[model samples]
Target chain A: MTEIDWKLSQDIQLLRLVTVGSVDDGKSTLIGRLLVDTKGAFEDQLLSVRRKRGPAKESEIDLAMLTDGLAAEREQGITIDVAYRYFATPKRKFIMADCPGHEQYTRNMVTGASTANAAIILVDARNGVMPQTKRHSHILSLLQIPHLIVAINKMDLVDYSEEVFKGIRDELGAFCAKQGVHDLITIPISALKGDMVTVRGDNMNWYDGPTLLEVLESLEVTDHIDEKPFRFPVQLVNRPQTPDLPDYRGYMGQIVSGTIRPGEEVIALPSMQRSTVREIVTYDGNLEEAFAPQSITLTLNDEIDISRGDMIVKPDQMPKKEREFSANVCWIGDEPLSVRKKYWIKQTSNLGKVMVSGIEFKTDIHTLDRVSTSELAMNEIGRVSFKLQKPMFFDSYAENRATGSFILIDTFSYNTVGAGMIV
Target chain B: MSKRKLTQLQALEAESIHIIREVVGTFRNPVMLYSIGKDSSVMLHLARKAFYPAPLPFPLLHVDTGYKFPEMYEFRDWFAKEIGAELIVHRNEKAIAQGMNPQEYGVARCCGALKTQALLDALEEGGYDAAFGGARRDEERSRAKERVFSIRDEFGQWDPKNQRPELWNIYNGQIHEGESVRVFPLSNWTEMDIWLYIRQENIPIVPLYYAKERWVIERGSMLIPFYEGMEDQLREGEKPTKVMCRFRTLGCIPCTGAVRSSATTLDEIVAEAAAARRSERETRLIDHGSNTMEDKKKEGYF
Candidate 1:
C-alpha cells in the first residue's frame, strides 16, 4: 500500500460521464474496465464478482457482473436501467452512469445523460454506427452535454484496423455534427481487451490521440452556470419564532444560476414584489456573495409576502412567467399519455396541475424523425404543450437546466410519469 | 461575474442541501434517518445547514435494534440535544420480547425482524410521507443503481426493475397514500467523500470510530468487540483479547466488526479510509450471502 496524498485527493475535480450505446455495445463492460484498470474496484467487490460470474482463472474476471447489480438484469444477461459507478485517478474523480441501450429504455438514457458533463456513445467496430448510437447521440445533444466521446469499441475483433475505425468515426461524426455537438472526441478502443482505455496498447499505435481515460481526465468542463442570470426558487422560508431571533425572515433556496450579493435589488415572481438582498446566510457564517449551485438563505431588505413556490431574480433578467408553455417530454409512465388527463407538474419547488393541451409530434427513436402523434406511450419522446393552473416562471432548458426542467407526476399513482424540458 | 467556483466538496454540500430542502418542500411529513454513523453525522449537519436559522424542520428517527454499542447511544442522545432536533428511537419490542437474538435465529432472521421490520413500523407510526437516509451509492453494488428519490410501494417494498426515471435535479416526490419515498441526499457521496466531509466540517462522531484499547475476539477475520452479556455467545475455547481497534461502520453490537487501526483523529481516519483496500461494508458481519443488501432493500430496509 502507498501513502495517501490528502492534498491531491481533496482537490481533485469531479467529472460526471454517462455511457450509452446499444444493448451489446458494452457500456457496462466499458465502465467495469475503467474501474478495474484505474484500481478503483475494491478487492472484496471483485472477489464477489468473480465468485458469481468470473472465469476459472483468478486473473480473468467477468466485468459485466460488477454492474447489472439486479437479479433480473443478470438473469437476462443485459442492463435494464441506469447504474451509477464511481472511479478516480490522481487528477480527477469520475462518476459514470452506465445506461441501458435497449430501444424501449430511452428514459434511462435521458436520465443518465441529464447531469453528465460528457457522454461516451459506444460504436461496435463490427457493426459501425447503428441506429441506437445515433439515437443516444441525438438525446445527448438534446440534453446539452458539453462533451461527446465516441468510443469505437471492439477494435481487437476487427484486428485493430484503422479503416474500420475511420469509417465509423466519419459516419458518426457527420451525424453528430448535424446534432450540433461542439466538443466531439472520437477514439478507437476495445473495452474487453483493455486497449486504449486507461492504457494505450501496442495494437493502437496508429491512433495518436489520448486514451479514453486521458480525455475524461483532461477535458475541461465548460460550465457557464455562474455567468448566467441569477434565479432563485424559494423552497422554504426560515423563521425562528423563538425569543432570541424574533425578526428574522430568511428565504432558503439554491441559486440555480448566476451569482448574488447583498443589497442587490431583485423581484419575487408570482407576487412581483421587489426587494434587496439584505444578507446571504449559510451555515459557515455570512458569505460576502453566493453563486450558482450554492444553497443558502437570503434575508430581504423588506418582507413583502414571499413564500415557497416563488422565484426571485434580478429585475433586468426576468424569466417567462406564463400559464401556457411548450416542452419536449419523454413519457415514462406504464400507461400511455392522454390529452384529457390532468397531471401534476413539479418544477423548481413549485407544484401545480397541468393539462396536455396539444401534442405537436413524437420523435421516432429509431430514425430520429418527427411524426405526428396524438398520444405518447412508454419511453416515447414528444413535443407537447401544456396549460398550467397557475402562472409559473421558467427558462428554456438549454439556458438553465435547473429552472427549466420539470417532472410530471401521475394523479392517481403519484409515479413520475413524464419528464419535460421547457422549450 | 466573480471568478469564484465551488470545490467538489462544496458542490456536494450544496447538492445535498438542495435535496434536503426538496423533501421538506414537497412532502407533507419528512424525517431524517440517524444511524449514529459518520454518514448520518454528515447528513444531520447538512440538514441543520439546510434550514439554519429555523432549526431542522423535520425530526430524526433512529431504528434501534437494542444491540447498539453504549457509546453509540450516548453520542446519539448528545448529538440530538446539541442540534435541538426531535429524535425518535423505535425498536421492535415484539421481536425483542420473542428473544430473537442473532445467535439463536441467525443473522438474516434477527436483522429482518429487528432492524428491517422496526424501520417500517416506525415509518407507519409516524405517518411520514418521506424518509431521508444517508445511504450512498458507493457503499454497495445494488445501491449504485438506486435513485436519489427511491419510491416504495404500499407494502413498503422496492421494485428495482420498475423505478421512476429520475432526471436533472428535479426529483419526483409524488407518492400515493401508504406509499413513501426514501430520499438519499448523500446518494452521490462516496465513502471517501463522507470521511473527507467529516474532516472538512469537523463534524463530531461517535468516539468508537477512533481507535482505543478494547477487548475483542477474532471470528473469521472479524474483531468482535466484547460488549456486555457477550460471554454466553462466545465459543467454548475462545477468549477475549485486548486490542487497539475502531469501527468503520456502526450497527448492531453483535454484527459490526472493528478494524485494527491507530487512527483517532479525523485526519488520520480520512487518510486510512483513502488507502483502504476493501469496501466499507466489509466490516458489517450481517451482510452475508449474495446481494444481501438488495434483498433487504426490497423488503424495506433503509
Candidate 2:
C-alpha cells in the first residue's frame, strides 16, 4: 500500500456537490460506491451496513444502505431528506449532499442544491432519459450550479455498449443545450458493478474518458464569489469600550461578495449613510484588506448610525434598493401561498413584512414550460412579485447568490414557507 | 495556496461565526446550550469571535443532569468565568428528588426524565425563543436529516416528517410565542473537523478527553469509569480495576464509556480518530438501539 500523504491532502481545496435523480436511479448506490471504494467508510460502519443487509444475493453488498441513514428511509426504501456525506481524496475533500429523488420532496432537493457548486444527475442506462431526469436538470440549471455530470449508471445491464450510453448522453446534451447549461459532461458507469465510478472496469475497455472521481478531482476551482461587487450585510454592532481603547465601535459581518480595503468609500443602504473603512479587525489582529465570505469587523472613519439589516457596499457598485421586485420562488410550506397574504421576508440580514403582489407564472419542471398560476402550492416553483414594507438592498440571483436570495416565513405560524431568488 | 485564501478549517469557522451572528441578529431572546464538551468548546469560541469587540450577546445554559463528570462542572465554571459570560445552570430537581437514576431506570427513561426534562423546563422558565446546540450530522444516522434551524412545536417536540425546508445559508429563526428554534451552527462539522478546529484554535476542553489513569469496571463490552455513587449499582463480583482510559464522548458518568488509548494530545486524538475502526458515537450508551436518537430528538433531546 502507498503511504498516505496527509500534508498534501490537507492543502487540497474542499468541494461541495450534490447528487440528484429519480427514485431507483442508483444515486445513493453511486455515492456508496464512491465512499467505499475511496475507503471513506470506516470498518465498523461497513460492518454495520453488512449486518443490516436483508438477505440479498450472497456476493452482493447493498450499497444504497450506506446513504439511507434514517430508519424511515430504510423502512420505506426511499430517501426522504437530504443526507450529507463526507469523503476526501488525494486531490480534494468533498461534501456530498444526497438529495431525495421523490417528486414530493422537491423542496428538499432545492435545499440540497442551494449550496452545491456542482450537481450529479444520475440516469439508469436501461431507462434512458426519464421525466424526472429533465426535472432535476432544470432545477440544477435554475440554481445556477456551475457544473453538471450526467452519469449513465447501470451500464452492465446494457452489456457495456457504447451505443446505449451515447443515446442517453445525446438526449441529455440536447436538453441541457436548450436550458443554457455550458459546463455539462456525461459518463457511463455501473454503480453496482463499480465500472467507471472509481476504478475503470475491464468490461469498459472501449471507453477512454476519466472516471467519476477523476472528473470531480480535476474540476475547476473558480473564485466566482470574489468577482462581484462588494456587499457586506451588517449582522451586529460591536462596542468593547475597554480601558486601552475606550469608545471603539465596529460593524461585524461576513463579506458576501468582492473585496473590501481600508480607506475605501462605502454607502450603507436603506440609511444611505456614507463612510470610509477605517480598519478590518479579526482575532489575529487588524488586516489591510478582506474578501468575500471572510468574517470580519469593520470600523469606519465616521460614526454612522448603521445597525443590523444594513448593507455596506462600494459607492459606484450599489445594489438595487427597492420595495418591489419580481423573483422566482419555490413554495416549501404545506399551505398554499395566497395573494395578498402577509409574510416575513428575510433577505440577507434585513427582515420586513411582505405580501404577494402577483403570481406571474409557474414552471412545469418536467416539461420546461411556463403555465399561468394564481397561487403556488407545496413544492411548486413559480415567478411572483412581492411588495415589502421596507426597502432591501440586493443583486440579481445570477450576479450574487448570497444577496439575491430570500426566504418567506408564515406570519402566524412563523414557519419558512417559501424561498425566492430575485430576478 | 494564496495567502488571503482560507483553509477548510478557517472556512468552516467563518461559516459558523456567520451563523452564530445570524442567530443573535434574528432572535429576540437566544441562548447557547453549552455542554462542556469539545463541540461546545468550539461553539463557544465561535460565539465569542462572532461578537468579538463586545461580549456574547446572549447567555450560556448548561442543563445539569446531576450525574455529569465532576471535571465537566469544574471546566464549565472556569470557562464561563474566563469568558465573562452569563451562564445559567439548571437541573431537574424534581427528578433528582424522585431518585431517578440511569443505573436503575435504564438510559432512555433516565435521560428523558433528567437531561431532556431539565432542558425543556429551563427553556420554558427562561422564555428563550431560540437555543443553539452543538449537534453535528455526522454523529448519528437520524441526525443526518436534521435542519440547521430545527423548529419545535409548543410541546418542544420535533416533527421530522414535517420539517420546513432549509435552503442556502438563510436559516428561519421565525417562531410564535410558545414555539422555539434549535439552531446548530456545527451541523456540517464532523468529529474530525471538531478536533481539527479545537487544535487550530487552542480551545480548552474537559480533561476527561485525554487518557488518564482512573478506576473503571468492565460492563458488557464497555469500560465504565467508576464514579463515587456507582458502588451501589455494581453487579455481584464486579470489582473496580485501574485502567488507562479516555472518553470518546462526555456525558453522565454512568452512561458514557471510555476507550483504552494513550492519546494524550489533540494531534494523537486526531490520528486515532482517522485510523479508528468505529465511530465515536458507537460507544455512547444512549444510542445503542435502532432509531433511538431519532426518538429522543422528536421528544426534545438536543
Candidate 3:
C-alpha cells in the first residue's frame, strides 16, 4: 500500500496453498517461522510474546501461537478454522490459508484446499505417512491444487537421518503421483529447530535445494488467467453527468478472465446487447486496455441498460448459458443438499434461482473416486447437478476457476452452504 | 473533468461514486456517518463528488462523544456550512453530564455508551436505513473480512461468521425491518492508500494529524496530552514527559494515543508511516485487548 505499484512491484499472484497433516505434525510451526522471518509480525505482538512467553529455550520461538489466536484453539493446541495469512517477497505475494487437520474437521480441510495453488502436506519422519495423509492427498488431487510439497518435519527426533527422510518422501510421492498429483517437491525439515525453513540447518548434508521460503517465493503463480474465457461482471455505473463531463457512463468490474481493449466487440449479458468497446475506464480514468482480475470500467457506444448483476464478455466467447449444469461441490453447512431447495445461486454477477437438480455423485476423499449419490451432508465433497430458474453463462471449473467458481446461498438464512466449481 | 477517460485514481473515484449513488437508491432513508477522521473526510469528499450539481442527498450524522479535538469541530462546522448539508449532531448528554469518564467506567464501557451506543441510538432514532462509513479492510484483521453492505442486527452488531457471501461487486443490503446496514465505500483502501489519496486529491483534514506543539504528558509508550477535562492516570513508576507527537489514528483522547513523531507534513507522515516500527493498531488502545471490538460487536455494543 505504501507504493502505488505495490501490487505490481510485488506483482499480485493468487497462490492456492494447503498445509495438510495429522496433529503434532509441526505444520503450524513451519508457517509461524515463515511469517516471523519475513518480517510480517508487528513489534507489539512480538513484545507481547517476549513479555509473556519468555525467551525460546535454546531454540527458535513458537511461531504457531501467532496464527492459532483463539482461546479454544490455543487451549487445544490445534487449528480449528482455515485462517488465511498474507505475505509477500520482492518477487511475488502469497495468500496462505492453513486448514484444520482433525478428522471431525475434514470438511474444513476440503474448504481450505478448494481454492489452493499448492499443497503442503507435512509428514512426521518418525511416524511416516498415516491414514489422514492419504485422505489429505486424495482431497488435494480431487480439488486439483496443482503443486505438492511433502515436508518431512521433526527429522531431529529421527537423528536427522537422510534414510528416514528419503523413505517417507518416496512413499508419499509415489502415492500422490498415482493419484495424478505429479508435480511434487519433497523436503526434509525440522520445524522446531528452524531447519530448512527460513534458514538452512547444519544437519541436512544430503539435501541440496532452496529453503522452504525460497521454494515458496520462487514457485510460479502459474499464469492460467490467459487461457480462461473472458468474463466481466459489471459492479458500478459511473456516469458523472456534470457540466464538466457529460455522456460518460462506464460499466465497472474486475475482469474474471480473458482480455479487453478499446475497439474489441463485446456483449452485455442477459440483455444480450451487442456493442463495441467505446473505451476502457478505471478509477484512474481510461486505460489503453485491461486484462482478467484487473478491475476496469468499459464504456460502450450504445446506451444499453446494464446495471449491477449484469456481465460483459467477448461476442464469440459467450459461456455455456444454460438452465441446468453439472458441478463438483464441497458442502460446507450442516444443512444437506436436497432436491428442490431454492437458494440464491451466485455466479459471476448472474444471480439465479438455483436448486439441486439431482445429486449426480459424491467423491470419496480416501480414494479420489466418484460415488453416485442423491444428497450431500456437512463437510461432504461431491459432484452434483444444479437447476437454475434463469440461464446464466459460465465455463467449467477446470477451464476457469473465476467464472466457474460459485457458492450456494441459503435464501432466507443467507449462509454459504456449499462451494462449487462448475463443470 | 472534460470527457477525459478515468485514471486509476479517477477509476477508484468513479467506482466509489457509483457505490455512493447505489446506497442512495437502495436504502429507504440513507445517511453518511461523519467522524471527521481522514477516512470519513475522504468519504465526504467523494460523496460531494458523487452527487455534484446537487448537494449531498443524505443528511450527515456525526455522533459526537464530546471528547473530540476542538480543531475537528471547527473543521466540521466550516465544511458543513460550506457544503450546506443537513448536519445532525447527536450526543448522549446524560452520560457526559454524569461524569462517566472513560477512566472510571473502563474504556470499552465508556466508548460503548458515548461513541458506539450513541451512534446506534442516533441511527435508530433517525431511522436511517443505511449509513456510509469510511472503514477500510486493510486496517485490521477483523476488518479484512468486512464487505461493502455489512448487515447489522437491530441492535447494530456485526457477526463475522454470519455475513452474506459477497461475490463480484454486487452487495445485498436487503434486511428485515429494524435492521440497518453499514455501507463502506472505501473498503479496499489502506492507511497508506488513504494518505496517498488525500495527497493526490488535496482533501482537507484536521491539523492534529500533523506534528504540532501542545501541552502533553507521556505515559506508557505514548505521549498523553493535556486536553480539556481529560485526566492522566500515571502508575507509580511512570512520569509525565513531553515529546513531539502526532496521531496516526484518532479517537477519544483516553483510547487513541499520540505516537512519537517528527513528521509534520502529509508527505513526511506517509514516509514516516512507511518506516515506522509499529502497526497503526498498536497505538489504538481499543484493539490492544485481544477481542475488544469482537466482544463489543457481539454484545449490541456496536
Candidate 4:
C-alpha cells in the first residue's frame, strides 16, 4: 500500500481464472478457503460471516457463505450468478470468476469463462466425473480457454486414496483429450479441510504436483495481443481544431491486436483507404509507439472520411471483409433464435443488421455430439451462418478473440440475445 | 521499462478508458455521474483521457441531495469549470419544499425521495440513454456480480438476478427510448487502485478526504459532524467534540460517518486503507437499512 515502484509492479502478471463444477462440488468452499487463507477477507468480513452462521455446528464456519452474497442465494444455499473475486499473492494477481453450477446457468458459466485465461473444474471424489463436469468442459473447450485444472475435491472423504484420484484423473483426462484440450492438470484436494489449495497438504502425499495456487502462479501468461496481426477498431474521431494545432484529426481507439509505430502504413477497412501513422497521442503525452490493449489516439497521414465503426489494420494482414459467415452462437435471450430473423450484431466497434441464414447444428454439451437443429433456444449453443447487411471485418475465433467475437441484440427490446464466435 | 508490459494500474486504466469510449460511441446521449468523490474524480479523469484532443462527448450529471458537505460542492464547481465539462446539477425541489430531511423522515425515505427520485427525474428530463457511475465491485458484496454495462428497465429498476452476461471487453450499450444503461467504467477497480491512480495521475480531489480538526458528535459508533442549527437532534447527554477526522465516503452530512485519522496525504490514505480491517461501506448509515444498498439499487439508486 506504500507507493511501490510502478515500473516494477508491471512484472506482476494478472491471471483471470474461473471456478466451475456441478452443484455442491465445493466450488464456493474452495474460493472461500483461498480468500480466507490468503488474508484476502478483511477482519470485519470474517466477523460478519462468523456472526451469520447458517445451520452449521457451533464451532464450524460455513465457508460457502463468503461467496453467496445475495440474500436469495444465501437463502437457497446455492450460487445463482457469477460472482467475481479479486485476490493477490506475491507472485501474481488474480481475478477469479466463481460461476454457478446449476444446469440452467450455463450461460453464466460461458460469461465467466469467456474472459478467463484458465479454468479450475472441481469434481467430487465420491462422484468422479459427472455429466455436469463434461458439460462444463465442453463449453470451456469451445471458448478456447488456455489451461484447465481438474481439482478432485473432498479427498478427506475418500481416505486420500491414490487409486480414486488416478481413476478420476484418467477418465477426466480422456474426456478433455477427446475435446482437444491438451493443457490439462489434475490435483487431489480437500477444500473443506484446506488440503492442496494454498499449501502443500500432507494428507495428499500420494500426489506430487504443485498446489493449486502454485500452478496458477507459475502458469504462462499469454499475450496474444502483442503477437497477432494489428487490428484497431476506431471508436471515435477527435477533431480538436484548436489554435495550437489546426486540422488535427486523430482516430481514437484501443488497439485490439498487434502494435502501431510512427510511419507504419495502415489501411482503413470497409473503405480500404490507406494511410501512415503520423503520431500516437495520449493524455499524458505523445508516445513513440503503442501496442495492443492500449487506448491511444492515432493521427493518420491521409485525410480520409473516416469515422466511428472503421477499422485500421496492416494492409497485408487484413481481416476478411464479408457479408456472410459461419459462427458458433450461444443463445442467451428468453426467445429462441430462428433463421431469417433480423437482429443487430455488434462486433468490435462495428454495428450492423444481421439475419440468420442457416443453423448447421447444435452441440450436445453432455454427450459432445452434434444434433441437427433448426432453432436455438435459451442457453443453447449452435453453429449458425449469418448474412450481414454490410460487410464486416473479422477473423476466426481460434485466431483472435478480440476481432472474432460479437453479440446479437434484440431489435425490438434492445436486449443482448446471443454471443457469437466467428468460425 | 518495457513498453509492451503495462502495470496493473495502467491495465485497469486502459480498460476503463475503453469502456468510456464505447459509451460515447454507442449511446445517443451519455452522461457521467460525478459525485465529487475519489472514484468519480478518477472516472472523470479517465473520461478526459478517453476522448482527448476533443472535448468530453457527454455532460456530467451530479444529483445534489441538498445536504452534501460544502467542500464537495466547491470542488465540483471548480473542477467542472477547470475541465470545461458541461455540468448538470439536479435536485428534488418538491422534496425540499416538503421539508424532507434524513433526520426528520428517517434515512430510507429521505434517500428514496432526495437521491433516488431526484436521479430518476433528472434522467427522464435529460433523456439520457446511458449514465456512467463509478461503483466498484470490491466495495460491496452485491456489486461483485454487477456487469460493466448494466441495463435498467423503463422504470429504472435493476434486475440483479437476470443481468446480461458481459464477456471480454465487448459491452452491450444497446437500449430503447425511456430505458437507460448504467455503465460502470471502474467496475474492476478497487479502493486501493483508486487512491494509487489518483496519486499517480496527480488528479485533484476534494480536501475533505484529508484529515482536519472538525466538530463532531459521537452517535452510537459513528462520528457525525456537528452542523449549525441542528442542536435539537442531539441526545440528552451527548455533546459535540472537535476531533481530527476525515470522511471515507462523501455523502449527506448526517449520513456519512467520519473515521478518526491523521492520514493527510494520498500515500498515507493508501497505506491506512491497506492496513484497515473494515470495508469503507461499513461506516455508511444508508447501507444499514435492511440491506439497503441492493434495495436502493433496485429502486434506481446509483
TM-score of chain B of 4: 0.97
In terms of DockQ, the best-performing candidate is: 1
Q: Is the docking of candidate 4 incorrect, acceptable, medium or high quality?
A: medium
lDDT of 1 by residue, B56-153 (tens): 88899999999999999999999899878899999999999989988888888899999889999999999998999999988887899999999998
DockQ of 1: 0.72
After best superposition, candidate 1 residue B106: deviation in angstroms?
0.7
Per-residue lDDT, model 3, residue A422, is: 80
Q: Which predicted model would earn the best TM-score?
A: 1
Give DockQ for candidates 1 onward, in order: 0.72, 0.56, 0.22, 0.55
TM-score: model 2 vs. ground truth: 0.95
| Residue-level error in angstroms, candidate 3, position B35 | 4.1
In candidate 4, position B203 carries an lDDT of 94
For each candidate, give its TM-score against the true structure. 0.97, 0.95, 0.83, 0.96
Candidate 2 lDDT over residue span B201-254, tens digit each? 788889999998889999887998997767987898898899988998898887
Question: Clashing pairs in model 4?
Answer: none
Give the Å error, residue A86, model 2: 1.6
Q: Backbone clashes per model, in order?
A: 0, 0, 16, 0
User: Which lDDT value does model 3 have at A319?
Assistant: 80
Every prediction: chain A TM-score: 0.95, 0.95, 0.89, 0.95
lDDT of 1 by residue, A70-171 (tens): 888888998988999988787778898999989887788888888899999998999988888877887787777888899999999999999999999998
For model 2, what is the alpha-carbon lDDT of residue A51?
77
* Sliding window of 10 residues with minimal summed lDDT for model 3 chain B: B1-10
